[model samples]
Target: MPPPPQKEPPRSFTARWAALKNIPPFLVMVWRAAPHLTIATMVLRAIGAFVPVAILWIAKLILDEVVRLAALPDTPDGLAGWWHSGLADHLITLVALELGIGIASDIIGRLLRLVDSLLQERLVIDLSMRLMDHAAALDLEDFEDAGFQDKLERARRQAAGRMSLMGTIFEQLQDSLTIATLGAGLIVYNPWLILILLVGLIPAFLAEAHFNARSYNLDFRRTAERRETDYLRQTAASAETAKEIKIFDLHRFLSGRYLDLSRKFYAEARRIAQARAAWGALFSALGSLAYYAAYAWIVVQTLTGDLSIGDLTFLAGSFMRVKGIIERLLSSFGSTAAQALYLEDLFDFFREVPEIASRPDAIPVPRPIRQGFVFENVGFRYPNTEKWAVRGLSFTLHAGETLALVGENGAGKTTLVKLLARLYDPDEGRILLDGRDLRDYDLDDLRAAIGVIFQDFVRYAMTAADNIAVGRIEAREDRGRIEAAAHSALADQVIARLPAGYDQMVGKRFVQGVDLSGGEWQKLAIARAYMRDAQVLILDEPTAALDARSEFEVFQRFRELMAGRTAVLISHRFSSVRMADRILVLHLGRIEAQGTHVELLDQPGRYRELFELQAAGYR
Candidate 1:
């Protein structure tokens, strides 16, 4: 799937088969899905092979009768004898047989094609469904990497075209089989003629091989360009880009860019088309010359009476039927092999390296969680970063506690919260849950047991209640819980103010939806986070967008609303930080001081200095 500047795959016999072997499973998978249709196509082809022989046989009969009548003497009885004895009737019968064979061949061919189309459609549908299912199953982290995305894009692209390639391959197989059978019939009549036809095809076969190689090489080299073209199309056509495009009045701008890439694609295709046209013309002429040579030799033998007209006709018929079969078989062989490598790319994704691999199976219970979740000796650096974002950090909270993480920007507060929420597993040390390692629980279970209200929470372009309902997908429609959660977070007022209340949509991007103010959205996010009814909740600046009154009111009811829950608060607001039962002041990725707000205010530390600075501003 990685489209890049590249050379050709091996065009030799051995390499072609090797490539075919690489994707045997995919070929086998499709083959298995429609075995009856496959077998029927092959059988139809085998039957159609005899149609050419029937025509040849009939032609020879007609030729023999005409020759007999021409050889008659000039006497009255001799002239009329051949005509009277049903010689014309015999010729008419031959003509009728030829026409019948032609009609039967056409019918069978159409039927086979119809079956091929249906079979390919079914297989493609299954392939696309499986790919979508697998993509959804992959962990959230894999989507972050760039290399993975390239392969995924390629896989998706190929899936659409793969069905067509596969069907063509099967069709080619049928063509080859039919040609071979007809060739065998020709051998029984005149073996030398088959050799002459094969010799005539050698130049064409070689030329086609060269062209196919060049075509694939061109495709391999322009992968990145193709991706850029896809991006350009999306930018030009998508609704998301419509606003900017209309504001800038940039129709020509996008159209010109699209045309530029399209012309480049067209230029490459034109080059290949021209080469094929020239080669095809040359081969066609060669084939015509070869056929005339064979025809002349057959006529000469017929004149000398050394060969029957029947044998000559059969030779001519089979010669044309079999010439391109070898090329087709070779092309199909190549395609079947290349499909293997694509399937390999798809299967490789299933091999996962879990982000957290060393945890025990037994999860520790929070039975009471009186001395709430604790972070002890916890240190974490991002996967490829040199510096720790949060290092050797330690803090503790009790149930019903709202402890604020106070720090300057980039002082590791958000990183600490993410670590506690287990969005990431610490590179060193562990997160202790009620004096035990947090890694014991199943990853899904652990994540489901907590709620997070991010400052940058997504504003869904869906109905207001559905946005909150996404919190617990398995739960029944609990209108009561949904309403209560909204009321507590002060989002009920936002909904009530809307024309349609809870059923109203919340974004302009979707139908019948209106965008909300920053403060309204903040309250919605908070309500959504607490909607799941989890035991522990982490709010990373949940009220940052709210007005002074909303912020004060939420914090005032914070204790009553969050009772019996272990809640951790993150904020830059001095008033909110001062009210936490315990305040942990962080500096340079570690806790510099921890105490109640008044106790921290008494100390000459990072917290006290920040508090004094804020107090002076207020005065």
Candidate 2:
């Protein structure tokens, strides 16, 4: 939108390389790649260098003969020899050799151009894989961090820029070699000209370096804004917001906000480009002066008898080629600096390295739990939040106990369950398994001990069998066991009625697939959770989508399903929860009351009032 942001290339040395701290590592990568590029370029440059020196000597030999040709007598032999040296016939042979040098330079250019492409391809592939591996090792909490996510996104986008930097490095190396060869040729003709050319390059290089730093600073400052723009675009396009957006008719409202920010981003980009162009125009004028003066000096020396005709020809022809190589070398150096700036973001990402990297201390996860877990004064608040979601919370589920947790929205019921499942650790107190702190147990062991079904369960867009089998991904989770789980969750009825049965895809977004109704999806989710023969189980509003018939059957078989295991159940519906051995009505971040359902009904506190209200809803 709005022509995507303008990304014009650097115009001056300052604009290109002002951001670079050091060029050593970039030079290292280029140097490593030099063996292939340099071999071809060095061979061509040697030819160019030798030809010019030969032409200069030939010009000295022919100069005196040309000056006296008019006064010589007209003998036939004298005329034939005069036509050769008197007409600068040797000079013409020099021109042909210079032309051959031009051909060689072009050949070398094409060779580096082709080989650099293949090397960049391989380097980028290896770096991308490494970036992914590093990112995957970070802590899960870091992915949610705004700063970390922004850096990761910027690093990912800079993949092309990194290759561009490497290419610039290779190009600069080749140009530097050409300059060295040409400079040597210039010294042979007139040492004074070489000194003057070197003196003129300082201002141009400094200016270009300054501009590069400025551009890098600008890109760094815009990282946060770019991430914000991306967030807005995702909100506009994602499936998560589609239903609400359509209902509110907000497409235009959202689209205008996106366009406004995009225009602002572009405006700043164009401003930076304009400043760079003005700086480049100044240097372009200065470099042109050097071009003109060098030629003028060479011609003046030839007219005054200080330089021979062949020397004059060699100086004039080689000056432009030499100056052009020097300019290109400086420009590529600046480009490498800017590229290194972008690469700094990648290095910053590595500093955070993921927490998921394996530790040598991690023993194998015990396959099953022998004794159930205990929660002792567990308290938790997610990082950076002021309010605790659950505090002074303590509970225990010995082997074969089903403890129901009943609470309103945000009542810490779900928080308690997550702690029990070890998705998070308690802030103040420790949870234990048979007197051992849970942290002493392997993370994999703790997770494998429980099977969980969240209130917002995933409806996987896969075949029914595959979806259920995803729960126990370690083993070849049996098809027959999957079918048995479906029967236990009362989802077998829905499977029998499907057109393709167990093979049916669960989402209608694809060809030849049928999406299920709300209750059917719930049954599938419950069956998925039941796939693991885990020692502990958690069902948080597991029947929220089920019909009355399915709900009754699930709760009816609740004991057998939870047999020889520990469980914590969460529900707003009192009827389903009333079957538990004990009930806890949580209020705010603490347990308000706890008792058998009958005892709570007699007490007529929060639990009794809530249960009565649920009963009234049926009437």
Candidate 3:
């Protein structure tokens, strides 16, 4: 709930340049994504770039010929005379060439767009895949951090939208080529004209770059605000929260919250946009002024007999085209530079390496967990917090024994389970598995040996069988195993009553989905642990929602089902806790007492008080 972390300062020149450097690699990524389509798009664009210049030149020639024909006196004949004069032949050829170039340009344009779209689509899929893979590899702590969530949100946007950058680069290149060819023609007439046009564009280009950077900075500063806006919108409208929203009459509250955040974002956007528009209009006038100045000079030269009508038309046409291309090139360059800053987010997320990675030469977890787990003065506090969630916790779970942890709410029971599973390494002390440092074992192999189901387990909107199969996802298709696990967890009876049996959808997120009662959902979730077939099983209050009778039945079979495996059961229900071989009482992150239920009752400590308190409620 803390405020979002501040973004880094506006990119320095070195950082901006580094961002620009990523463009080449991004282009390389695009090429690798769809090499054939990329090459084809570029080849077509290269062909189309010069088509405009060719057409313009041909039009000039046709105009000059028509003027010459008009000057000649008419022959004795009428229409036939004009056709037979041989002057018409050259005119006809020029017209035909212009028409052909125009047609070819249209065709090439469409083909180029088609190829670009295809390339963009492929790159989107490729980039999204890489994003998901990289995110999956990140540590759990990263996902829990708000700053990292903001980065992920930004990266997701880039994944969906940044593929168009490839097309932008190609278009910029094509426009530059067009400008070069047209400028060559104008330079022959008057090099000063080309220089004037270039000068006119400099102000506009600089203004655009400045505004683009401002916009980028604005967006960077508002990452937290944007995420809040998204969350508010989702809460107001999403299926998951809709029931509560209606029950609490929270529609207006959520709507007001959403509007507040959106208005701030809109105000900031409006300010930046208005400034950009004002500067854009002013700079655009400069370019227009420069163009007209060149126009007057061309007309003066024509009137003084220094230039022909044909030369005047061609020079003016080339100058206009050159001016437009320069404008487009500069605008695209600014846009590309701004987009490169966004690329920093995408690349930065990739640059983050997990701090909890295993050592290169780490050993694998013991197959049977011989000596079980040992916590040697372990202590941990989450990142960015002062208080330890669990501190000075030293305990051992003997192999093949079932240990129960009893504690009040917020006693750090869940934190202990997470530590045991290596979801987090201790900040202060080391944990050992079979006497080897837990960090010394292969991370994946070590996790695969443990199965944990927490109280807030997800109820996936999937088939009933798929829900349970999540525990051992690799064996999801094994029907016999799925049923066996389900039966062991007392969920098979609930599934059997479903309309489609094992294939029945279990949550209301999708159509035709059936919502289950609290106890029934807990049964499906508990089945996951049975499916995992792991050496260590930790049930962290997964049975909390079950009825008392159901709870008694589950615990009655718990020991029999988990005969040889090491187990840890964390629950508030003393009936369940007392059934364990031994009980450890946790209070404020430290074990206040440890012994069997009978021994703890005799000690007259925190455990006895808590037990008597629960017993009084029943009496």
lDDT of 1 at 66: 66
**Across residues 375-429, which tens digit of lDDT does each residue of candidate 3 receive?**
9898987777877888999989899988999888878899999898888889988
Tens digits of per-residue lDDT, candidate 2, 487-544, equal 8888888889888888888776567777788888888888876788787789999999
User: Quick one: best lDDT, which candidate?
Assistant: 3
Off by over 4 Å in 3: 1-5, 11-18, 68-87
Candidate 2, which segments miss by more than 4 Å at Cα? Answer: 1-125, 159-161, 187-205, 238-240, 299-322, 353-365, 448-450, 456-535, 543-561, 575-583, 595-599
Clashing pairs in 1: 19-337, 20-337, 22-340, 23-340
361 Cα displacement, candidate 2 (Å): 3.7
lDDT of 1: 0.72
Candidate 3 TM-score, C-alpha based: 0.93
Query: Best candidate per TM-score, number?
Result: 3
